[model samples]
Target: MNSGTKQHPWSRYVALGDSFTEGIGDPEPASLGGYRGWADRIAEVLSAGTDDFAYANLAVRGKVLRQIVDEQIEPVLSLRPNLITISAGGNDVIRPRSDPDEVAVRCEAAIERLKRDNATIVLFTGPDLGFSPVFRGVRGRIAIYNENLRAIAVRQECVVADLWALTEIQDPRMWAPDRLHLNALGHHAVARSVLSALNVANVLQAYDPEPMPDGTWRGARTDDLVWARTYLAPWLLRRARRQSSGDNLLPKRPTALSLNGPRA
Candidate 1:
């Protein structure tokens, strides 16, 4: 930790990644682009302090690490941010043919570039997918991916959010209706995690999610059918067509600007 880091807020904070960083599932009607995920939450808090803070979020949903590197790494460096975060590769690792070693190397490379630019790189270990029935097949791969992230953080001196360690998020309520993304409460927990890692005090507490429907076996089966009909089927169709949810989407904040204070 730098002596002056606490004395001054980050002048420029750039966030780069995929849907997780893009604030999916946690929709905020008032927020720009109708999303308010962890990065936005943290940025809001940072901007509330006495020191000025400029923030930019360039994350889009469904991005892989290579695509992030190809499309974003240079842009983030160009912004010359004091703090930058890179959280991606979830989409990549889940593929049937993914190579863990290659993905790890790519992640490390991204961190190395951030270090070269002299930014405090904050990385995230993907959340444990074992809790999701549909994602169970990739649980082993995700474990390996999380392991790689921890090792990379140790070697690169980057902060890892360690989402897998947060038992609070394992609950069904932490997930969105689709069971693929996090709901508002889950995003809040992740924001708290990131804030804690940055040694920032978070007044934005993680709260109990809104009450859910029946959790009994019969209820579960009913809900599962609903989910498949509502979300999972459409998602699979999109994947079959090689269309991304973010194909036409743009970053919520394409340029850095002073956050001034928390959004109401």
Candidate 2:
């Protein structure tokens, strides 16, 4: 007589980031198919054979770096994820103050916390916004943030995905209309890129040919891709313009209202 039981190979993953990580505007109904975010795609690619692997996407739209560290990340760690993917700092760099040092500190803290649990961590640098017309002034800020991120990744011995350089040369159409988030094709590209980095870092096992597609996997079609790309890309561009203009129109604070204002 034998007992019946199944064992899962790679079951637990935790994803951390802001809007991009959350797959904002990818579409409604967060299922396996239809606008699957990169993290979900990665989880699927890696956990193809195992039922044990589970992914928890803790990303919140519009979340800045510090907010994620304080609100979302701590609770996720209690679950003891085996793998963690963090794609934060975009909101931090885009904010008016956009303090790179502060962002780095929070990211470092997240990494340390995850490492304490013996989790394999992957940190994603922001995509280069140099191509975006509205994000021109903050382009330099992105570079600074990447530098800090790279230093921290090195120190923590974690994997760093250089999405900044990869997406920079790609066509702007790869981005959604918002010009910030990625469309389906872009998400697929990101998934491949991140998977490759994980493989290179020896965090993930080499890919084996997947079995014949059961009715389970619902890959997005061209029409879905086009719609996502066409609609969201422009929307992102418009949003970026509004944000840039708002930054430009901001009035200088009165001395009394400023933190450094009115010397005692």
Report lDDT per candidate: 0.82, 0.62
TM-score per prediction, in order, is 0.91, 0.70
Please give, for residues 101-201, the per-residue lDDT of candidate 2 as tens digits: 78778778878877977788888887777666667788888888899999998999898888886752255545564555775556656776786777622
Per-residue lDDT, model 2, residue 81, is 80
The candidate 1 region of ten consecutive residues with least summed lDDT is: 1-10
Alpha-carbon runs more than 4 Å astray in model 2: 1-9, 28-35, 200-264
Candidate 1 lDDT (Cα, 0 to 1) = 0.82
lDDT score of model 2? 0.62
Best by TM-score: 1
**lDDT score for residue 31 of model 2:** 44
